[model samples]
Target chain A: MPITITKSTGQKELLNIEKVKHACRRAGASAQLCEVVGQEVKQQAKDGMTTKEIYEIVQGIISKEHPPVAARLNLKDAIIKLGPLGYDFEKYIARVLAAYGYNTELPPILQGACTTHEVDVLAVKDGRAAMIECKLRHEIGIFISIKDTMSTWARFLDLVDGSAIGKCPHIEECWIVTNSRFSHDSIQYGHCKNMVMLSWNHPKERPLPAWIDDKGLYPITLLPQLEHNTEKSLIDGGFVLLHDLATADPSLVAQKSNIPEETARDCVKKAQLILQA
Target chain B: MPITITKSTGQKELLNIEKVKHACRRAGASAQLCEVVGQEVKQQAKDGMTTKEIYEIVQGIISKEHPPVAARLNLKDAIIKLGPLGYDFEKYIARVLAAYGYNTELPPILQGACTTHEVDVLAVKDGRAAMIECKLRHEIGIFISIKDTMSTWARFLDLVDGSAIGKCPHIEECWIVTNSRFSHDSIQYGHCKNMVMLSWNHPKERPLPAWIDDKGLYPITLLPQLEHNTEKSLIDGGFVLLHDLATADPSLVAQKSNIPEETARDCVKKAQLILQA
Candidate 1:
């Protein structure tokens, strides 16, 4: 049975099982499991199912077999929901790095030989610092391209040169972190340069979703009940991590974010579920 | 005779004396003088004159009476010829300030409260510094809009805020110098904010052309003999001012720029003529 799925952008297209298998492989699912899930998803497919609905069904089948892989797949869509707000996304990245025992400097605008460059997040530990460039995408189809990778490398090089000239502090490592997938050439170039790149799924060495899941530092945007004006309020109040929201008093969310007490309680409940999920 | 004049981009337009008169008026030419020059230029027009040729005829007639006013008019087109090289233009601006007894720093990237910004030329004299933003345009019809003005203001504000916090050097004034004309709103906003804006014409007090002539520091691009590859080579060799080329030996120009000695000598001769003109 063939099925037409409606996308978030209101575009409808026939769902292809090959695409499903490809995404599953990219997410590191076993081929045998992918075949089984593909068959089950096709069986459950209907004419007017939304893409989100289809993804939920796929997640259900996949999670029964592999929960971590299921979480990673869902995490892609979850990160996309975190912006339009770029600074909020940067804070979220900081939270994730903090969980890994790295002290992050929020924005270090280092003077360089050629120019002054603003590094997104500077992670320091044990007298070593990594200058990081974070590229956050709110849209699903956007990819971090080779141009971005090259520019980041150039900025890193300039800062390193600046350090040689006593303009800025010395950086020991360079990293580029993004919520979206990487372009093929960018991944190849980054691998060749030994530059650490953490995207949605590339370099199987350390994909971002796995890093987040292992650290259990999910963004507050992932909470189901916290949205729109409340989300903006929370972000304005510098509340970014789900763990922080989950542990805080429900009345604090209501008072600070000006949401109803019932809604605040529901947000806390959702955040707790996400933490335990 | 109705003449067809080709623009730099190779598009042709009929030579209209009315347009000539309008240009003359905009350049602050007297009505009676504009009428006389308009008639004389029309009489001198041939079948296929270039726009540059027409401007020269207008300039020659105007210069006979008012040399500085003619230099101001000719300076606009001369500055336009300086780029596609932005860094060279910044150097040219620095040289202009140097001529006016201001100690200038090239490409100083100052850290601000919000971000790091690279100021094109920082002019300091007697314990006061002015951060300058230079906008160089290669194309003729393009005007510097209010958006550029606002962003420059924002950067200036951030740097001033940084100075308050002791992040960088204290900037006493903010100035924007552009080869092109400023938009009406940009001029109005600059006036309201007490910001110094030197464009082709708008800021009646010390406009860019007037300021350039006051310093007598003409860019080497203004030399008619220097164009194309030779212009690029001269700029690359750090020979931005015509006065420098006029003083430089032809052998040195030939060796440094790899142009023929004869061409180098011709460039120097032309530079001398421009200096005297």
Candidate 2:
């Protein structure tokens, strides 16, 4: 039977079980599991099915089989839903830094050589401070260009110069953090300038996704069925991570978000599964 | 007297006549001309002066002393004003190619291996066909990235494959034309793939600026006092090149652009002087 799969944007496309199976396999699902999911999905599928509906169906099965892989595949889309508010991204990064034993500040004004600069994320650990330039990309295709990397480098230099002149505290390190990939030139410039670069998939030694997974610091947006308003409330209530939700009482989540208790319970359950994976 | 000059975006800074002179010198002005212009500009300048106003004053002087240099300096800005309309840029590229003895088409639909691709500018000359990808940047700081280069290569390969399958004529060359610089990776990718890159300042042997200046095919944005609407009308009327405007009857241009005859006359005069220089 032919069925139209609707995207989160409300645009619809004809559902292709083969494509779904391929995606599942790419996410590290076993071939046998992929076939089983594909067959089940086809039977349950209906015309004008929303992608969220399809995702929920598939994720439910995948989380049961291989929870970690499900979380990894869902990460990109989860990060994207956190937006329309850039400040929240800064907060999220601050939280990530905090998990690594760094006392983090969102955006602090520090005197640069020429002017006052607002450093994105300031992390202090072991008596050394790092001025991090947090570049958040909502779109997957957007790569951090060389110009941005250069601008960060200039800012770092200016801040260092400020410290040399005793205008601000001396920074021991500079870092560029992004949720997406950096352009080749950016990577090269960062390495040459000795600025630590952390991206979603880079330096392989300490990628952002692996770091987030290790700390169980997934953004609240990663919880499936978390409404936009609820996400905002959770963030405002100082609950920004999936780990927070996984550990919180489901009733507390429902009260904070004004969401149905059963839905909140379901979300908490998914978060727990993802964290375990 | 010191004056704080302002930018179009309202950013203000102290005016420096020496900086203006340096700009003129970089634009190929003579030392004497630069000095004279600097003195004249300083005298005419006041606090709260905009960069646009300064450009006009300096351009007026340079066009009188060295028209070609004036045209060359104005080239980058002129090409920029051709947008918000990307199609105008493609047409501008077509005119440039035409000057080089190539008949060009804008966005001709050519079959790729799996899908139909709309080639940006297809140039035919000497019994060889070239598929050109015209990458235009509206902002100055944006650089063409490696992903774009790779996408163009993929399209070129698909087009070549299409020819193998008898879907279209064989393309003997693939070229990327941009009015901005390309990232290091883009340049490297182009070289490795043997794809010809023609940018504002790349491939050192022949840059876009040099090619346009050599052909005397300056875009009409070079006209100092050309109103935005009139420029659009002139471009729409097929008067894309400065050479075309310079050689056309002033009355004809006035009629086409719905502007006064005298203004058209002055524009043509400036164009002629620039060409002579």
Candidate 3:
């Protein structure tokens, strides 16, 4: 009998081991490791078990050999942990955009045609510019709705109108970036208006997770055994990425985060291991 | 010495007795009664007291003679009590529109050019129709932001496009109705777009509270001494307006609400007193 599993969205379906392997592979696990994790998950998953439980099983199998891939698998949860507020996520997106050769800034109150707008991230590359709206949801199963996309478009229109009248910078593109999935209507509206929407699994060819995984841009929050306070301290100290922490001197990290040198050294070692892997 | 009182937004100002008198007069208190209440508020007022404390003093003075006016004074809070969700507030707005001779309905699902919209209330009058978005905030000091107004306009545009393509209803006006105040940028945007924004104090004249006071259209939630469960039952049974409950058959109210007939009769009598006053 096929074992049934409940998805995060409360829908039930039969557990497919191929999907398990595919997810592991997407998280940067080797094909051999993916097969091993898939077999382990198939053995353990019972009827009515949640997909979250199956995910933990896969993470455990991958973690024993490849801790970095396991960390990458937990990327969605780590990103959610970045916020009860979205300011950090906005900074993270700016950094990600910078990594892709875009010079980005969190503009201070851009004046639109009708009113002022506090834009989240503005990225410029090769004489072209984009206004990015970051929609961060701390909870799972919450979609970025059409209302959000529509408002973003409206703000873009105001900016365009302002630009025509010499009030604000001209934005060539409007982008909505979210850690969660977009609603179907949001996706349709975005496509219809030619707005660039980057979410967890949108655009099929290169979604947000794919971009992070391709660049190995894992957040420091994904480090295993990280205390909440220490993680907050690292993020506050501008060490949002594991690469940042790994490249920094341990003593400086300790001084900046106000933590013991030994703890900082251990954190650095863990970050180095993850990056090296 | 001038007494200082804190406004709801945490700004402190000198207590203006004229403002208190104005508020009382706005609530339909007799000019003589307004004078009495204003004097009592001034006598009891202290430095660093909240405007809410002063409001209670006015309500106490008025309740003894005009219970209905006192209830009307609580209209803002009463509307807030209508929601943790916005559905009841939408229904209340629809009823209010109906009372003003607009044929209204909560459309099931409206198809726009790009996507489907769950419009809050659609009101039609004199061969012109409007799509009203009801924004109900449960907390005080939360202003309806520009993003909300812009999105409503975007949705309205989609509906207009849909009508041109024969996909949905043609709306002549777009209105945003809220029990809270609108942000300054929201007001600017609404005015620029010619959108009708009816909030607690927008338009300066004939605001939401003024409209409610003009026709004595108090919600049933304003009924004094109403038990929480009893209020829920009455609201669920379609007694949203005080006038509706006042004119309802007492035995029918009791049977529908599953309350004692005497309790229902007492509720009716209280409603009658408020409506008559």
TM-score of each: 0.47, 0.50, 0.89
Q: Write the per-residue lDDT of candidate 3 for residues A183-213, one digit (tens) a residue.
A: 8999998888899999988889999988888
Could you tell me the lDDT of residue A83 within candidate 2? Answer: 77
For model 2, how does the per-residue alpha-carbon lDDT over B1-277 read when each residue is reduced to its tens digit?
A: 7899886436698888888997787666789999999999988997888887888899899878777788767877888888876778888999999999998887558775545666889999998899998888886557887657756765677678789989987898889998888888677767766889999878787788877866678888887777888788888777888888889999998898777898888878887776666
- Where model 2 places Cα greater than 4 Å from the true spot, the runs are A1-277, B1-72, B254-266
In order, candidate lDDTs are 0.76, 0.80, 0.89
lDDT of 2 at A219: 91
Q: Give stretches of model 3 more than 4 Å off.
A: A227-239, A245-268, B99-101, B227-240, B244-269
**Residue-by-residue lDDT tens digits, candidate 2, A148-188:** 77567656766787899999888988898888788886777
| Residues B192-211, model 1: lDDT tens digits | 55778987775676676666
Instruction: Choose the strongest candidate by TM-score.
Output: 3
Q: What is the Cα-based TM-score of model 3?
A: 0.89
Backbone clash pairs for candidate 1 read none
Which candidate order results from sorting by DockQ in descending order? 3, 2, 1
| Model 3 chain A: ten consecutive residues of lowest lDDT | A138-147
Clashing pairs in 3: none
